[model samples]
Target: MGMKASYVVQPFELHRKRLRPARQEAAQSESGALKKAENLAKRMPGAAALRIVADDETGELESATILEAFGEVPDDFAESLQGG
Candidate 1:
């Protein structure tokens, strides 16, 4: 088994006074994810850069981290990312 790391940009939208996730995008690197999230935040309610680590063979999540958050992100964004 091997561990794999991934970077992703998640954009958020406000709906009925709630922050909801929009389409998610994969990034080549952490910096790329951060840049993408920052750009998306301009036109979105919020955006976040995430780093996720998991087992490649089992597809089990090892951890999820919020690298950065832009604009009006959810108050429980970090907890949500951790599947809490």
Candidate 2:
């Protein structure tokens, strides 16, 4: 084999056997994230209550007094954390 050909296959062929576990782990992590998304979607339709807590007056967090539909998350979800 030529020098370039041998070098090209070195890392790939060497790591071929190790790819399975790494791929499996990535797949498992993706599956878990998908499951969480599905669960949240399922709970969305019945989300009738939300508690907004603003600990600082300087914070721009605001609470919603009306919802046109269910599962409506406030835009200030992350802003609410700024108070702390």
Candidate 3:
């Protein structure tokens, strides 16, 4: 089985009172991804939110599972990641 791991920083921009994907980065670890996201967020001209997500390839290239999430994550995000 082939397994892959990656950390992603998903930046959200506020528009019309809703958040939208603005920019993102993929890193080797959660902290690294979060740091990159924060730097990008600081450069953005508007208000934004950065989310750190851990993604792991479950031997299936078409699908990836989230192992953990942090920073302005949704209430159900973690729960869903946990398979609850």
Candidate 4:
């Protein structure tokens, strides 16, 4: 059976808007995870630098799943970081 015009028009009658999370909720979101990690890095300079390797695709990756590639920096690495 053919659909009625009302059915087709129903979608157009609606207004869609993006919803941003509240400050507390946003702070808990994944986007905030990176910020949190950076703050942690500042406090724990001796701690391993955050390193995460992900295969291209979709889905979630846990914190423990992320690779922690850190340790002895090359002599030049520090100089390079200082932009010299």
State which candidate has the highest TM-score: 1
Model 2 clash pairs are none
Q: Which residue runs does candidate 4 get wrong by more than 4 Å? A: 1-27, 46-64, 67-84
Best by lDDT: 1
Residue-level lDDT tens digits of model 3 in 2-67: 445556666556568654556555677756765666666565532222233333444333334443
Q: After superposition on all CA atoms, what RMSD does each candidate show versus the true structure?
A: 1.0, 22.7, 5.9, 22.2
Q: What TM-score would each prediction reach against the true structure?
A: 0.94, 0.24, 0.47, 0.25
Clashing pairs in 1: none
Residue-by-residue lDDT tens digits, candidate 1, 1-20: 99999999999999999999
TM-score of 3: 0.47
lDDT (Cα) of model 4: 0.26
lDDT for model 1 comes to: 0.93
TM-score attained by model 1: 0.94
Per-residue error at 44 for model 2, in Å? 2.3
Clashes of each: 0, 0, 0, 0
> Predictions ranked by TM-score, top down?
1, 3, 4, 2
Q: TM-score: which is higher, 2 or 4?
A: 4
Per residue, candidate 2 scores C-alpha lDDT tens digits across 1-84 of 111100000001114323111111111233343343334435442111222323354443344221111233344433443443
> Ten-residue segment with the worst summed lDDT in candidate 4?
5-14
